[model samples]
Target: MINGSTNEFIDRISTCQDTVFIYKGKKYWFQGYMPNENTVHMEIFQIDPAKEGYVWEYNGSSITEGQEEFQIAPIFDGKTFWEVEQEMEWVDC
Candidate 1:
C-alpha cells in the first residue's frame, strides 16, 4: 500500500506512469484512468519465479474506485492505507 498520504499517492500516479503499489504483499500497476467514471484503473500481478527476468503474472484487478478526494478506496476492507496508518498510531498510544 502507499506509505504516504492520499495526496502523495495522487501526485505519484499523476506524474509517473510506471508507479506501482504493494497491498497485502502483492504488487499492483496503474493501468490508466477511467475519465467517464472518474476513477483510475489498476491491475494486480504476481511475480513469476519461472521467468528469467522480471515477469509478472496477471492476478486480478483492484475492485475499489477513487474517492472524491482522490483516495483510492479499499476493496470491501473498510480501511484505506491512510486509515490503517492512523490506526497504527492509535495502537501505539
Candidate 2:
C-alpha cells in the first residue's frame, strides 16, 4: 500500500523517466519502485578515483546506500554494478 507522499513522488518521477539529476555535482537516476512499501530507489555513480555505482533507497525522509542487501536486489540480478555505471548519461531537467 502506497502512502499519499509516496504516490506523489512516484507521479513526479514518472514524468522524468530515465533522466539523471545532479546532486553535489554527482549524477543519480531513479532505478525502480517498491510498490509494497512505497519506497523508491536510485543509482548514484562514482566518477572520481575510478568509476563505481552505488544504490540508495529513498523513503521520503532519508536516503541510505547498499543495494545488494536490499530486498529488491534479486530483481536486479546479473546487472553488474559496472554495467549500470557505464550506462549512465546526464540529462537536463
The reply for model 2, stretches above 4 Å from the true place, is 1-10, 14-16, 33-51, 58-91
Every model's TM-score: 0.37, 0.30
Candidate 1 Cα misplacement greater than 4 A, ranges: 1-7, 33-72, 85-93
lDDT by residue for model 1 over 7-52, one digit each (tens)?
6555554432455554444444543444344444443233222214
Specify the highest-lDDT model's number: 2
On the 0 to 100 scale, the lDDT of residue 91 in model 2 is 49
Model 1 lDDT on a 0 to 1 scale: 0.38
Best prediction by TM-score: 1
Worst 10 residues of 2 by lDDT: 1-10
| lDDT (C-alpha, whole model) for all candidates | 0.38, 0.39
Screening candidate 1 with a backbone cut-off below 3 angstroms (N, C-alpha, C), the clashing residue pairs are 1-22
Output the lDDT of residue 80, model 2.
39
Instruction: Rate residue 86 of model 1 by lDDT.
Output: 34
| lDDT per residue as tens, model 2, 20-88 | 433334555555444455454544344333345554444431223323333234223345333333333
